[model samples]
Target: MELFFKYLQYEKRFSPHTITSYQTDLCQFQEYLKEVYDLEDISQADHAIIRSWVVTLVQKDLDSRTIHRKIASLRSFFRFLVQQGKLERNPTLRIKAPKLAKKLPAFIEEDAFTQLLDQSEFSADYKGFRERLILELLYGTGMRLAELTNLKLADIHLASSTLKVLGKGNKERILPLNTSLATSLSQYLVKRQEAFPNNNSPFLFVTDKEAPLYPKYVYRVVKKYMSSVSTAVKNSPHVLRHSFATHLLNRGADLGAIKDLLGHASLAATQVYTHNSIEKLKAVFEKAHPKA
Candidate 1:
């Protein structure tokens, strides 16, 4: 497992969050194997043992997506074992993953988001300034929460209306900002400086203590304002991001261009936005079409 960790950290260059997930999943599988079947060695794990563990996960009522992730961790570990000549074959290869439903990504309406930023009042202080910028950057740039957290003071190029985002897998992409987002960013910087005169934190967003905002703090901040502005079934920072892409597509933004802006790796990943657009079109057609 240490060797696997080294490979993931040094060779694969996976992020800490991802490495932790892999570690937890692998450890759970090993504990299950030892307790259930008295199988101490994971190297002897085969198709039947792997399948049984999956069945137990289903019986435990875990989310299908979560089960899929656990299986993926096992598969990766097995592949690594094979590469090191410790195993003849990977057993997870023969197992079938449970079928998953294609759930549409939830998004806030343009009017709702517009009202949130324009009409709603934030406190006339540093926290308010920081919170507003958090919402603006997520919705404006269509960046993920982790990307926003990892953002640095130098990443914002306001003069050019752009941001250099380091996204998943440490891949860097350029995202353009609108006049409104650029304006909000500019405002936040001045207040941030006044709020923390001696603070040398390199993070773009920070707590009152001048420390970088953690995932949960950011979640609470976005969730609170999101609840105020929209009644979407889900209210998270990513909802704002989805709203960004969906609204862009509805306004005739090209799919490929939206893909690039959202930092999607492939067109297939980008096509999901089209489904949201189609649903909107259907609702409009039902109301306005002559032939009902």
Candidate 2:
């Protein structure tokens, strides 16, 4: 376990959240091994035993994505063990991850998004302004919830209309802001200073008590406002992110640029939005075709 964690920290350069996920997956696998085979060391595990574990996971009715993640974790762990000379060969080499259908992400329409923003509950009060800013920034920048929550005051450059965000794997990227978003952010900064006064919290968004906003607070705020806006789609920050990307794609934005703006590690990850755009085009064609 220590070796795996050290490998994650050094070789893979995974972030704390990703490292934590790997640790959790390994811990769960270890617990399963203990209960079923009374095995403590992964190196002692064999191919048949690993196959049986996969069967058990299937029998337990875990989702395809969850099963895939477990397989990934096991593969990484055993490959590391083999590299360290603890194992003769990797047994998980033949284990196949469950096939999963690609489900297109749900996104809010442009009109619905505009309506939500127009009707959002905003006030001159510090918390109100802070929440409003959070909403604006999420939609405007398409930043991940964790990225937004971890934002530091120094990361924002109002003069340049750009924000430096530290994304997954500790990779940093510069995300640009629009005029409206920059204005909203500036106003919020002024309100934040007045509300917090002498307090020195470096985070961009904070609570009423002047502490940094937690993930749950952000989720609740999104859920509360999104519930009023639309029941057609699930209410989450990620949905807003999807809306942001989809809207950009529908408007003919370049795929490469969108990938960079969203801080995706690869173009393949960003290409999923193209599926949503195609579906929209198909709908329009079906409605407008004279032959139909």
Candidate 3:
């Protein structure tokens, strides 16, 4: 397990959070095997044993998505074992997880976001400027939370109206910003400079003390403002990302363009947003097609 985590950290370049999740999933499975089947060695576990674990997980009331991820962690670990000659065949090779119902991603209406920005009262201080810019960057660029979090001072090119983003797996992409977003960011930079003249933090978004923003800080900031404009079931940075993609698609942006803007490697990931578009189309057809 230690060696696998080392490989994930050094070779796979996976984030500490992702590595920790894989560790947690593996440990839970190991404990289940020990308690239920008295199986100490994971290598000795067979397909039937794995299926029984799946049944137990289902009985424990875990959602299908989570159970699928746990199984995926197991599959990857067993594949590693097979490569290392510890196991002759992967026990999870034929094991299948339950199918999950597709759920469309939720996004705040563009008008709501505009109202939140234009009419809402935010402190006229550097801190408020910084917080507002965070929302604009995520919604305007369609970049992931991690990409926005790791944004470097040099990555923003105001003159070009573009932002260079380092996405999943260290892949970098340049996102062209709208005029409003560019202007907002430019103004925020001036406020930040005046407030923290001696700031040395390389991150784009920082706390009031000029410290780099942490994940929870980002989440809380997003949730507080988003909750005011939207009663969304889930309010986080990703909701802004979904708003970016969904709004673009609704306005007739090409699917491929949205995919590139979101920095998604495969079209499959980007197609999830299309489901939102399809629902709108269905509504229009139902209301206007006269077939109803």
User: Poorest 10 consecutive residues of model 2 by lDDT?
Assistant: 225-234
Best-matching candidate per lDDT: 1
Structure candidate 2, residue pairs in collision: none
TM-score, prediction 1: 0.96
lDDT of each: 0.90, 0.87, 0.88
Best by TM-score: 1
Against the true structure, candidate 1 has what lDDT? 0.90
lDDT of 3 by residue, 144-174 (tens): 8888889998999999999899877677999
Ranking by lDDT: 1, 3, 2
State the weakest 10-residue window (summed lDDT) of model 3: 115-124
Model 1 over residues 163-200: C-alpha lDDT tens digits?
A: 89987677899998888889899999999999998999
Backbone collisions counted per model: 0, 0, 0
Colliding pairs, model 3: none
